[model samples]
Target: MWFRLDLRTLDNPALWEASQNGPVIPIFIWSPNEEDIMPGAASRWWLHHSLEKLGAKLRELGGKLILRSGKSLQNLKSLAKNTGARAVYWNRRYEPLIQKRDDKIEDELKKIGLEVKVFKANLLAEPSEVENKSGLPFKVFTPFWKQCLKQLNTEKPLQPPINFEKRELEPESCNLSELNLKPNHNWAQGLEQEWNPGESNAHLNLKLFINEALKKYTEARNFPDCLGTSRLSPYLRFGEISPKQIWHAIEESGEENWKESQYLTEIGWREFGYHLLYHFPHTISEPLRPAFNRFEWTDNSDHLRAWQQGQTGYPLVDAGMRELWATGWMHNRVRMVVASFLVKHLLIDWRHGAEWFWDTLVDADLASNTQGWQWTAGCGADAAPYFRIFNPVTQSKKFDPAGSYIHRWVPELRGLKPPYLFEPWNAIDIELSAAGIRLGQNYPYPIVDHSKARIRALKAYEKIKK
Candidate 1:
């Protein structure tokens, strides 16, 4: 069995089915060509550790995870031939390039008389199964998610199968370090401290969420100060935990309100993202709404750099960006705030934020990243209205009421109180002095006037509006 995205032994369709037949050979091929969607630095760090833990688990179960670096097809063909393997099984991935590659590989393997089976282990519902009444793929999430919720069989998730024995004919493997997945620089310390990427941790996190956070998720999820949102995103993105497992877990938790809960709706959004990506693959690079193609983007490197480095001069935006830099993750509401500031406030392209997140985010799924940026920019299918610009100060005040998130990330403003905590530059001389904030020095002044930037963004949208 080949493990692509699905990393866990629990609720893994490909692994469970293959083990049922007979002894299974588990192999991972690191294809250089996958660099297009290859994990960004933060994700690579998580993948490195996730693969390590997975290998250990397999070994504990009396099997070895053979790793190789080469063209995936060639490696698969070579390994199958050497091992006398008749069949290959793995979970499905939804990335356009990955799907194309997998399809060709499957066809070629089948031609050579190898039985290839790919199962849906990533998403709760496959995009093909959840469609509009007209048999068309959903462009709007409300109807799309409603369609999914109607079809959800949340009672039985695939059981976690027993461990399997290793095959006699084992292939030569390379060390994990040989893949060079970890960054060369000493930049991973923060990410290392923040996350534990493995199946065990995934389960633990889910349990913790259900125990502590689920009940308060609706109100507290928006508050970056609280651990209100499930941090299961990275695990889910890497397939360390299956959505089915999460679905059934919610059901079994006796949380009667889960069906109507905001947490479940968040899960639905993930399903919606995959549904969009599968049906309209080109949105990865282009705007889904064609009108956005003509939208003028300033492409200001300086402004973009400021945003990236957390020197954007906007306290809340800077804090969010800094948090992302320090840890591979950022709060969801903060993510939207930073994304909006990039596309609307700075007049930079949404693709810039998408690409940066692709590199920096540990939980960076291509579908979600693409959808989020496009949504923030009002360039995607069923996107947020472009006219509704987010005021970072108000958002910061509302969400991180005590300014702890900003204080934690932007330590320079830690001593500052509310209102000024959200917007330091607006504070009076005595307040700025008492807080030890120096405009354009310790703390940056506002990058762009919020009022001016909002108008600029709306005017840009006007071109595409007509």
Candidate 2:
């Protein structure tokens, strides 16, 4: 069995059910080209550690996660030939490029007289299964989520199977360093400290969240400074945690409180993203709303660099970006604001920001990144209206509130007052000097004027309306 995102054995439908039929052969392909699609260096480092943990877990179960390099199809064919394996099984992938590649491989494997099976392991509901009354895929999230909830009432999550027949194979596994990713890069120290990526850690985190944090998730999720939201996105993205297990865990909690409802809504949002991905394949590259494609985007590399480095001079936006760069994760609220600044304030292409997130975020999944960036750019289904631009200063004051998150990521501003935390440029000479802050030296001036950029973006978008 070949594993893509479905990394864990527990609650993994494809792995569990496949093991029941015959001896299971787990495989993971480490392809450099594919890795380049997203998560350039930092993500690769995380993958290296994740695969290590998964391999260790599989070994304990009398199996091994076979690591290989090169094109997935070529590698699978070679493995099948060496071991005389009869079947190739894997979870499905929905991105534009991956879907095409998988389809080609499926055809080639079938032609070579091997049975190939694809399982729905990534999402809660198969994207194709949820459709509107008219038999068309939904572009809006509300209707899509409602349909997902309806389907969940019909079918629930599957547990990990413990009864797979152990298969023995001496297939060659590649060493981690053979993948030739940029070595000597240790920029992800904070990410390593913040996240433990593997099946055991994922499962433990889920149990803890269900037991403790979930109840307060409803209120805490909105506040960036609070640890209210389930920090399970990276695990979910990597398939270390299954959505079915999460679904069942929440149900088993049995409190049925409003917080549970809110938490489930977030899961629904995850489904909504996959549903959009399935329906609109082109959304991976193209805009969901075609008119937005005509909007003029400034090719301001300096501003983009500032945003990426978290030096945008807007505390909230800078903090979020810095957090992502440092820890490969950021709060959901700040994600929205920083994304808004890129697309609406800087007037850069949303794809640019999305690509950066793809490279940096541990939680970066194709569907979520696509949905989020498109939503911010007003180019996605159920996106905010094109006119709504987030004011970064106000957003910082609202979400961070006490400047705790800002100070944590932006230590240079630790001693600044709460009022000026959002806008240090407003500090007078004495106050600025007292705080040891200099506008352009200690911290950046706001790269783009929010009010001015808002009007420019609106005008630029207006040109596309006609």
Best by TM-score: 1
At residue 362, candidate 2 shows an lDDT of 80
User: Per-residue lDDT tens digits of candidate 2, residues 216-330?
Assistant: 8778898888878789998898888887777777878875653239887888888889888878878888899988777788999999999999988998888899888878898
Give the per-residue lDDT of model 1 (tens digit) for 362-456.
99999999999999998998898989899998998889888888889999887898977887777899998888888988877777999999999
- Model 1 collision count: 0
Off by over 4 Å in 2: 32-39, 153-169, 180-183, 257-260
Give the range of the ten consecutive residues with the poorest summed lDDT in model 1: 160-169
Candidate maximizing lDDT: 1
